[model samples]
Target: MDAAFIHDNLEIKFLILYIAARVSRPIPVEGMQELTLCDSGIDYFSFSQCLNDLVRTEHLTLSDDGLYAITPKGLRNSEICESSLPMSVRLLTDRNVAAYNQMLLRKEQVRAQVTPRKNGTYTVTLHFSDDVDELLHLELMAATRDLAQGLADRFQKNPEQFYTRLMDTLFPKE
Candidate 1:
C-alpha cells in the first residue's frame, strides 16, 4: 500500500472525530476500528490510545454497551479543523462514513425476535419496513429454539429478499 495522507496524531484524532460525528448512530468499537484504520499511517496501538484519550477528554462518549459517539465538543472541533485534512482523505472518509451509515440504517429498519413457548416449540415474530411504512408483519412457528433463532437471524440479514420470496410463493405470476 502507499503512504497515508495523514501522518500525525492530531490529524488521526481529527479523522476519528470526523468519522464519529458523521455516523448516523453510536457504533461499536469494531465499527470505529473499521473507519479509523482506513489509513496506512494509523496503527492499532495509536488508534487505541487516541480513542481512549478522546473519551477521557470528554470529546467522545463510550456507552455502557460499548458504542462510541461524538460529543458536542468533538463535533465542534471537527467542524472547525476538518478542513486542515487533505481533500482526498476527507473525501474517502465521507465515502466510508456514508456506506457505514447506510448499513446502520438497514440494520435499524429490519428487526426480528424469537420467543419460547411452554408447548415446547418456539415462535418467531418478524417485521419488515421501508423508510416510511411497515411492509410486512408475520408470526411463524419453529420446532426448536435454535431453528427459531436461525430464522430470525437470516431474516434480519436480508428481510427484503425473504419477503419477496414469500410473496412469490404465495402469489406467483400467471
Candidate 2:
C-alpha cells in the first residue's frame, strides 16, 4: 500500500534472489531460512512467503532434493536491481552465504557407510576427515538396516557434535 512497505517487500524478495544467485550450489529451504530469518532478522513468515512467491513466479526453482536455486531470469533481475539494496544488507548476505556454503562442503566431506554383513546384521561406519587425514572412524553393528541407515544419517548431519560427545564419554576427566 504505502511506498515504504512496497519497497521493503521488494528488497526482501531481491535479497533472496541475490543469495540464491551468489551461492555455487543450490541452497536448501532450511538453510535459506536460517540465514535470512535467524541471521538477518527477516520475519519468518515473510521470508517463507517471499521464497514461495519466487518459486511461483519462476524466479527460483525448487529442486527435486528440495533445494532452491536462482533461475536465469532471477539472476538477470538481481544483476539489474542489486544496487538498490543497502550495502550493509548485501555484505551480510554475501558473508552468510559463504559460511553456509562452507558448512555444506564440510558436511559433504563427512562420510558414512552402511554394509550388510553375512550374519543378518548391518555395519555402519562413520568417518570425519579433512584434506590431510582422517579425524574419526567409528563402526557400529546394527540388528537392522534401518537402524544402521539412521545412525549413518545422524552422523552425517553433525559429525562434530557426535565426535565431541564420544570423546567426552570415553575420556572423562577426574
Candidate 3:
C-alpha cells in the first residue's frame, strides 16, 4: 500500500471496512464508531462513506440490514492491500460481554449525545475523549497511506471514487 493512496484522504472509513471484513460480521454503527475513538475521531458516517467509495470500485457489497459485508473482490483486495493496513484483534471475555450488554441499555441516550446523528443508531456511533481522537488520527493516516499506495500500484486506474467505496463497505448508509 502506498501512503499517497490515502494521503489525499483524511477519512478512516477504509479501516472500518477492513475490520468488518476480517470479522465477517455486520458491524453495527456504534461498533465502527468505537474504532474512531480509539486514537482519533473516525466516526461511523465517515467510515461508511469510505466504504461506499470502495463499493463504487466493486470492492464491497451492501446488505439489507444496513451492514456492509465483504464480497469476493473485497477479500482479494484485502489480500492485495494487506501490506498497507494495520492488524486488529478480537477478544472474548465473560465479564466484558456482561459489561457490553449493560451498555446497550443506555444505547439510545448515548446516540443522543452526538449532535449530527442524534437520530441515527448508536450501533454506528463512536464516543471517545479528546486526546484519543488525536492519537488515532495519526495512526489511521499512516495505515491508510500505505493502503492507498499499494492500491495505486495494483490497480490499472487510480480508482477515482475510492472513498465512496470505503463508505459503502463501512455503512451501506442507504
Candidate 4:
C-alpha cells in the first residue's frame, strides 16, 4: 500500500546484506531479486546497483555461475544493522528465504534423468534422497522420449509419493 520501509540506497544495501546472510546457500541473481525486491522502494535499477556495489566492495561474492552469497564482511555488517529493518520486513524476508531454501533443498534431494537408448527406447532414472541417505534410485524403460520426460517430471514433483507407492506395489499385503 505504501513505499518500502527502505528509504535510501543505504537501506537497500542493508536489505541485500540481510537477505544474503539469511539464505541457506548461494542464490542466483533472480533468486536474490525475488527475496530483496518485496519492498516498493527497491526497484530493479537500484537493486542492481546496490548488488553490484556489494560485490565490488567484497561485502558479497558473485560466482562465475552468477550466484550471489554473503561474504564474512557482509555477514558481520548484516548482523550489526539488520535490527534496523522493520520487524514486518524482517518477518516477510524470513518466510521468503525459508520457502526458497526448502525449494533448493528439494532440488538437491530429488533428481531425474532421461536418456535415449539405441533401441529407440528411453531410460528414465529417478533418484530420491534426504539429508542423510539416498532413499531410492530406480530405472525404468519408456517407449519414447516424451514418456521418459513425463515420468521424470512426475517423479520430481513428488518423489516421496512415487517411492512410497513403488514400495507398496512391490510388497503388497497378502
Task: Give the clash count for model 1.
Answer: 0
Give the per-residue lDDT digits (tens) of candidate 3, residues 1-174. 112223222325445444545552554556544542343334445555776776677766666776556678777766665555444311212233344445543332222121222433222112222323321111111124345344333321322243346557879877
RMSD to the hidden true structure, all candidates: 2.1, 6.3, 22.2, 1.6
65, model 1: CA deviation in Å?
Answer: 1.2
- Candidate 1 per-residue lDDT over residues 2-67, each given as its tens digit: 568888889889989999999999989999989988889989889999999999999999999999
Worst 10 residues of 3 by lDDT: 134-143
lDDT of 2 by residue, 22-57 (tens): 887898888887766533445777888999999999
Error of 4 at 50 (Å): 0.6
Question: TM-score for every candidate vs. truth?
Answer: 0.88, 0.66, 0.38, 0.93
lDDT of each: 0.90, 0.82, 0.43, 0.92
lDDT score at residue 13, model 1, on the 0-100 scale: 92
Ranking by lDDT: 4, 1, 2, 3
Q: Worst lDDT window (10 residues) for model 2?
A: 1-10
- Number of clashes in model 2? 0
Candidate 3 Cα outliers beyond 4 Å, as residue runs: 1-14, 41-45, 86-174
Best of the candidates, TM-score? 4
lDDT of 4 at 78: 96
Q: Model 4 segments beyond 4 Å from truth?
A: 1-3, 118-120
lDDT per residue (tens digit) for residues 97-116 in model 4: 99999999999899999999
